[model samples]
Target: MVNRYLPFFQGVVLNQATPTHHPIPGNGNVAVNFDDEPPLLEELDIDTGLIWRKAVSILHPLRSVDPSLHAEADLSGPALILLSLAFFQLLAGKLHFGIVLGWATAASVFLYFISSMLLSPGRGGRGDLSLYRCASLLGYSIMSMTIFSAVSLFLPRGGGLIFAVGMGFVLWSTRVCSRLLVACSGHGDGHRGIVAYPCFLVFMLFSLLVIF
Candidate 1:
């Protein structure tokens, strides 16, 4: 009897000593057993100086078109453009129109971002890419145009040189934007062309403003 009772107590002790596994909560009520997962990629912190550098790079095609370098650029280009527009407006004594146009410009930039994400194929579908990156690429692509717009305010309007410069910038920006999209989002030429259409419209609109 004592031996039998000893065996029973030992079995109880062993059962009690065994660790219990708890299910880890996942998406909803689902349980997952993964011990560890890879960490998510971190976003890049962009500043004004970085924005300027990215703008310069977009303007020059010979420069590296690596999308990773600009993975963290933000929507700061619209703000810069608005600031320059405001300065020009103030200079021309049309502060009211400047303020209105500034607001409109911000809205237009936001719309452009949304449209690009929606229209650009293969964006946010593969490998750590996101809509923020799309916005960053577009923003940086427009940097040179923004600067050119500001500078054009100082130059005499209606000159052949100004028209030529505006057209050149438009063409350059369109090509740069398409290439940047391809490099950053892995979009093919067709998709890049579709996405670059907005860039053309944007630069063309700016050109019109500069001209008339």
Candidate 2:
């Protein structure tokens, strides 16, 4: 009896040993090895050069901004810039990361309404702005404030130099943001003050966060 049942036991063992998973190539479903896939940086195809170029554009606040910088609306650089801003704030003895990020979101939304909602047309229009683009532009503009935050870390508290530097950085940030908005809006320089004013207020608050 034992010998007669051996074949049946062997068949059951063989079935259990076989793998159940198979590459089903149907209806957009395909087998993939997660370990074999590329890293997130490669998968997302992040262009470091583009990020660098945007930073370069932000550095020259007095110069005109390239409209192409807003074309793709990449957010990686902006995210990094904001994180840096928060970190700098953190280093300055303020745990305002949540507040910093929350305010950044609010600022982005505020600018989106000002820049895109007011300027964007119902249909195809020249130099239209999107919310993502607005956010990206605003993110890059904060670079100047981040610089102030870093510098403020080193300076003695209760000094007027921090105030002066913060004000200068706020203006620098406003100039860059306003220029980018105008360049992307196709409205020229006429509406820069409208755009810059809010930016000034936003960065001013950020400066205070750094100073205090």
Candidate 3:
């Protein structure tokens, strides 16, 4: 009697010991590892939130003025911030979204190209930095102005205070961009000042439009 049940128990034990492998869809004969832990979905969310918060912090005048932060800047995070701000401006109906986005993107690309030309190769034979990096520096540096643009939409007419605040942000963004250029381009203060001038003009133009 025990012998008959012994066979069934052995079969069950064997099945349990042998891990089942599931073939991944569309990848023929490729089996997923049952022992491997699945990637955490929450990580992506946390990373995105962190990037957004950094973007917002960069908009602060005091924070953007920090040279250390400029060195660590990357394109993806700031680009997301700019795009989100543009979307909000569009929803506010204060300006044409297409024009705003088109100009902002164009300015970022144009400045990146122009600045790259003016920059010396990175220090210690590191070679020239990528356009994406330059664009990130410029894009994130100008984020202060982007915030001002979004905020101006909600301010009442004849608000001199709003205009003053926008100007301050514009100046701060220019300073940030200039400092970043000094860091990345390995250029002296004078050259960096020259490089940052166009950034100032661009922000000034945009801020004026938003303020008026």
Candidate 4:
């Protein structure tokens, strides 16, 4: 009976693990005992800072080559741009237009988040989500809504200036968030850094073009 339920226990342990770490390869014979103390940090070199560096290395290029990364990032980029654009429209005293634009931006962001969750390597146990990830998403969502509200309230005045500030925040926030996700996955290496950075630069440039 005990042997039959061993795998079940293992699954629970795995589910609770950090995204950056995986089972010690070839250690399957180990039983999952809940009463057992959590694994030691040193056992896996599970440093958040180290993991972040590794994530940048792994994701930078793979993301660059992966068509899905391009598609997903593009979706996120446009949503961010629209969100900023809506603020400008509202600031210009176009309330109805701004609301419509804001709504559209919101929808796009939802899709972007969904796609990112699905397509990014860490949505499941192998690339599991974490508190930090949830917080990052929450912050972005709040910023998006706040910008819209501000535009709605103060029109034909501070739209461009506020929009620019918002865009800067979006750019830096997305870059850092992506890096954190990579680090948490514990694959610290520059393998993916090349692609990710370039693609991000392109995205930034595009946004700048829109701004200017």
Per TM-score, the best of the predicted structures is: 2
Q: Model 3: what TM-score?
A: 0.66
Clashes of each: 0, 0, 0, 19
Q: Could you give candidate 2's per-residue lDDT for residues 20-68 as a string of tens digits?
A: 6556777465665667878888789788888998888778757877767
Locate the minimum summed-lDDT window of 10 residues in model 1.
Answer: 37-46
Measured by lDDT, the strongest candidate is 2
For all predicted structures, in order, the TM-scores are 0.56, 0.78, 0.66, 0.28
The sequence of per-residue lDDT tens digits that candidate 3 reaches over residues 1-212 is: 34675898978877899858878899998988856764574534335554565566565566535455455556667666567666756766654566656777777777777676666464322334466676677667657767776677677757778878887888887887777766665665667666777878877877776665
* Evaluation by TM-score, superior candidate among 1 and 4: 1
For candidate 4, the 10 contiguous residues with the lowest summed lDDT are 65-74
Instruction: Tell me the tens digit of each residue's lDDT in model 1 across 171-201.
Output: 7767776666665555555666666676687
TM-score of 1: 0.56
Q: Is candidate 2 or 3 superior in lDDT?
A: 2
Residue pairs whose backbone atoms clash in candidate 3: none
By TM-score rank, best first, the candidates go 2, 3, 1, 4
Clashes of 2: 0
